[model samples]
Target: MAAAQGVRGCLLRGPLRARLGRGCSSGAPVRQQQQQALVAAPAPAQELPSTRRKGFLTEHAAPFSAFLTDNFGRQHNYLRISLTEKCNLRCQYCMPEEGVQLTPKSELLTTQEIITLARLFVKEGVDKIRLTGGEPLIRPDVVDIVAQLYKLEGLQTIAVTTNGINLARLLPRLKEAGLDAINISLDTLVPAKFEFIVRRKGFHKVMEGINKAVELGYNPVKVNCVVMRGLNEDELLDFVALTKNQPLDVRFIEYMPFDGNKWNFKKMVSYKEMLDTVRQRWPDLEKLPCEASSTAKAYKVPDFQGQISFITSMSEHFCGSCNRLRITADGNLKVCLFGNSEVSLRDHLRSGASEDKLVQIIGEAVGRKKKQHAGMFNISQMKNRPMILIGG
Candidate 1:
């Protein structure tokens, strides 16, 4: 019976055995040899599992780490740090007659302190930083501050938002210090109207600063215009026309309610009305896309060198995409613009909080971020802290 089975196996292997390289006769011993050959053959190599491949360094790369807020969310990577709570102009929509209490000089963060905090923020994924102020240009050592901030690693851009009163004298020094851009607040183009709106008589100075900024190659020099109903709202087109000849970016911001300006809803100008007014005359105006965290919705007319931007903070809230974390001159971390709640980094730092502890505190503050600002006009709960105090 064994011999017959071997002969049957040899018949089956008649043509295939030569390729496998072995005995090729048709007999019982040959059949047994073929069976041994089959048993000795290695199984086809199985593929390396995906999990094992992922574990290999060549297949898996490190992920980019971001400054995560308390709610386990990542932000838009921008920080606006206010240099002071003082300003030379008294724009009715921004500050009151009896100016808001100035943050004590002792309490204010020193340049070194600010730079340290900025470096830490950059380490944790803050890519852009804008130095703001009641007027940042008022700070005595602004040039040094800008130069120092420029040295922070991972910091892609550094800018200053000023009233442009002192820009002409400091423009060269500021530009030399690595300031990437400037946003000058000039609400009115008319000399008399400018004084009425800002309560200061320096229209020519502001214009000169704007012109100098342009001449010095301050790309996209932004002119921030706050549109108040009875105020300079009439000059909307006049301001927009500036963009036709120059390479300026003129932005009109909606008036907001805060302690500084005593914001009233009646005086507010809706962004829609402003846009409609412009489109009425400049029928060829086109809306332009802005960056993710940009407060303004930009637009430009055909064949124009200048651009217009509308910041509808009051009429059109863009809170869902808010990526800004503000540090008041006093060093308090404010997560939201209208938020009354604050985390005192000054107190923590003075209390001997380690750098890691300060970072953790910032993370917690960001975690408690409100999804949207409770409209200052709608909510009866007044913060009493004006825009100047909050670093508008």
Candidate 2:
């Protein structure tokens, strides 16, 4: 029956429309049915088992403490650690306007545990780690977290993705802590619209933080902007123009669906659309070479001080070269950003799982990664945790 029904069986469809109320825009109704029908197909029989028992990892651990490689043979070295799932701002796309139930502090990973897990991954050939959160800086000890991750051996890069609310004040301490890169999330240039979208009144402060990051010599201070149709879509060229003078790698991400965002296809402005708009304005825009595992389809405007990137996770899926593994604040490992599948490392670590045992768990988790996220059109099936709970 499952095979007969195929991928559509995995979708969470019926309740979405009723839940969306009158909030969804014009094209949502068409997408609602079409997206649901595009759910993920069943896994192949030869694929890794869906088992999550404690002993599974201990038995099938890979040799020589190598880095994680999924069934598709993609090597994983980059790790995104969600320090905490708490934020000061309430962005429209990230969560409900009324806000989400915050996770209790006791359930989250402690600083020591985070370090231990990070050290294990580093030892297993993981070279880079990026700290993320509902807003990483919200945690009182975020600077300390950066300070500690910097001290780990074999970990080459220490980066953070912040909303820039608390960033301006913490710039000095963060720079001193050996932080390597900073990615700020700023969706709009209009102060009023910014406040309306983020549900906060600190647009100037975030801009100040971006300036401080650039001024302090944080090379290529990347600014991430999520472009939605009715919302900030008109600012596509405006965002691109930011690169004309300053050294900002402005990234435009297509709007994605989640549990509470009331996401509809009408909201997303595709990568091709965004690029064409920019190209029409600046015909000399040149494509930049991207690393194998990069999610963004990067490009640079000739003679411009900085570059512009497109994280086309929606329209153009980049899963073929994916090399990332995410650890939620509460210690669950998510191999893919769009899928709901996860394994809890916190349970094993706290249960006295040895380093070897932990490595086994990591390997098993990576083995279960999906080929790609349900593409943009089929994203209603991706009813995973909201972006806030999943980090960034």
On lDDT, the leading prediction is 2
Across 95-142, the per-residue lDDT of candidate 1 in tens digits comes to 887767786799999888899888777666555688987889999999
Candidate 2 per-residue lDDT over residues 96-134, each given as its tens digit:
877878788889999999999998887664556889988
What lDDT does the true structure give each of the candidates? 0.71, 0.76
Q: Candidate 2: where are CA atoms >4 Å away?
A: 1-67
Over the full model, what C-alpha lDDT does candidate 1 score relative to the true structure? 0.71
Top candidate when judged by TM-score against the true structure? 2
Distance (Å) between predicted and true CA of 47, model 2? Answer: 8.5
Looking at candidate 1, the ten consecutive residues that score lowest on lDDT are 21-30
Query: What is candidate 1's CA lDDT for residue 366?
Result: 72
In the order shown, the candidates' Cα RMSDs to the true structure are: 22.3, 13.0
